[model samples]
Target: MDASLEPRLDFVTCASPAGLHRMAYWEWGDPANDRVLLCVHGLTRTGRDFDTLARRLAGRYRVVCPDVVGRGRSDWLVNPAFYTVPQYVSDMVTLIARLRPGSLAWVGTSMGGLIGMALSGAGAFAKAMLAMRPHAGMLPPDQGIRLDKLVLNDVGPRLENGALSRIGQYVGDSSEFASFQDAVAAMRANSQTFGPHTDAQWADLAKYLYPEQGGKWVKHYDVAISQALSSQTAEELAAGEQILWRSYDAIDCPVLIVRGAQSDLLTRATVDEMLKRNPRARAHEVAGVGHAPTLIADDQVNPVADFLLA
Candidate 1:
């Protein structure tokens, strides 16, 4: 742990229905600090994905970045089929129990956002939630809401298939990146947050990717995550979306929704409809990006940090 960053780094494991898996998380700032920040990454992303953001906020809050089960150093699920929001939520709940105090400030991206929403709706985690490019709705009976100060990053009810496929290049296969710089270049090119990455940021993600047999780099997540996506049938996907929609209606915490202007995942109509029901909700679009906005660059980090800290 860097002495400058107050919170010490600790590794812990949680035994969920899936099995026992190690979750390596970085806890920065002062351990005694009551202001806790939980930063979760998108699907196929590891907890280390938040290194830059965690480092930036270390001075003010106890930042916790957990490697969601099946990603990074976390153990793979006994049943790959359990690699959904519900399972992730179970593991997170366990993590929260060990963390104690039961409440936190959340920063979730993509799948992580959905998990946060589930926890909030169930009244089990976090005092405030900031979902970056979050997936809308968790259960069918519930309608999506617009809460004051919520940031929804470039994600909505519907997504553009082509753009989704394009974004897949970065998250799915790290083999394309010969070095960490290549990965950073790919992220900057497709990322909504526009800025250059420092050496530290690049080094952070570098430790998360490993070289495979072919000398190609691969993310440190279970391939089962990808298999989960491909194995889903259209009907099953729709059912899952309905479940999430109902759950979204139940979240009562302060929310911020930030959308990427060019994101194909979050549809305009969905945003409009969300605003219609939850008039309290606010939306912002990041220009010149698509699918998702990685919270690495200053532009992205500042907005998220401000929202959570506020």
Candidate 2:
């Protein structure tokens, strides 16, 4: 086994009256270092998604990546309705309380970015947040109006056609890799937009993939998360936007939004509005990418590292 950078890995649990139980995460870094970084994953992804990013950041920050409720190693909710942001926010609050830290930095992808937004507000946990290709208004509150600009991909207002099909594949797919290198190759193949990776980068990404009972390779995440996205209605989608806007306005911390140039999930108009609302927020658009920019390559990772390190 590879030597753990963290001496110990702690398993934690949190509960919400909404009847959701979330998993907590802690990776032991330098005992005396006070800086903590929280990396959250997108919908249908697990906490392991940050393996590469976290390992790279471990030297300077105690990186904590939580498997959001109903995903990865976390418990699933009985009520799919509870999959909304309110429930997610509540669970994250419990996580922040447990960490008991004075400040934090966040790296959030897609759905995860919205969660960071919820926490970056005046009373929330994060001191700064870097949001990548965030879902425009997948929440119940962000329906109607226009949610096409928050991200930079071709995802339709209503998830249908091959989009839904593509999502289902990752929600719980059947694929296997013979070795860690195999997994990395798959990730790189899937993430060609980010460009090439060194062997080390591939290994870093491989940590997130695992073999299944049937000996098939797949990501380490929960299958039920897809249900959460399926349950949202159009009205609910709009409501999610309202919540997002509120949280955006409430955020007092530094905010950076990195959008994929080819993404249909977030529209330019919406991003413009967000910038107007939060003058403190800045944005970066990655060319030749869609929906999200996996911060694996130097082009993607360097800017993020500089932002958080600065």
Candidate 3:
């Protein structure tokens, strides 16, 4: 495929406690298209994770995938403590202001999904408040951009501690690879939770996972991001759950919950609970997967496309 025809890289300025930073994004399709689809990656993943999905949806919507702060090409926070959902939510709102689409939809994977839920629910208000303070006069008047649709990929309000622990076990363990192939091998081993993929697909994924510097390869993201997860106590997690559930219940947009049938993070019981609380929400479980479905495969992408384009 011609690289020129692929998504264009861009960046937007966002504010944090450490000061100002730039958040990088990749945009596909017509820039003037009012229909916007924002695809966010998982905790340690980059916007490139959505390459396949973005290509499939570009003709229908203006697809934008952002590398969250502390990850991908985005700036690493001076204070790793700022690597929390609230900060991420703030950065997204800034990105939305820059996009200024007529309508917006979201496709979020794992940590990305949590940000979506917050934006769709009471979390929007949190962002609004954040914009008003500190960054006052930087954002335009609230345009009331409704979150038209949402696709939560293998994540919900309730998170399994065991799964989180498993993720933390390797998140910040950055390493230099002897070669590109070795990096791909490491990525495949650590991301087995992303389910199966062909060698070609894994190679494509690895390209974005690591970037070469000083004649060697290194993980693309800032390792400090793992600090937020590692320091969380049980009480803090429970409190966070209450906040997230409130946000979930407050959401009014149509939500499509895509679950990996074998996922350890989001369970069937949680999906059931999510459905009960939100009349507009539904679930579609993908077989043979574990923590997440990358939406790279046709079967996985089809249902999401149907929901968004419907």
Q: List lDDT for all candidates, in order.
A: 0.61, 0.59, 0.86
Q: Provide the clashing-pair count of each candidate structure.
A: 34, 30, 0
lDDT of 2 at 107: 80
What would the per-residue lDDT of candidate 1 be over residues 277-308, giving only the tens digit for each residue? 56455666666655567777777778787877
lDDT of 3 by residue, 88-120 (tens): 877888899899989999999999998888777
The order of the candidates by lDDT, greatest first, is 3, 1, 2
| Best TM-score among the predictions, by candidate number | 3
List residue ranges in candidate 1 displaced over 4 A: 1-8, 16-18, 123-152, 156-207, 211-216
lDDT of 2 by residue, 39-94 (tens): 77777656666665676777887677887877656777765556655567667666
What value of lDDT does candidate 2 attain over all alpha carbons? 0.59
TM-score of candidate 3 relative to the true fold: 0.92
* Candidate with best lDDT: 3
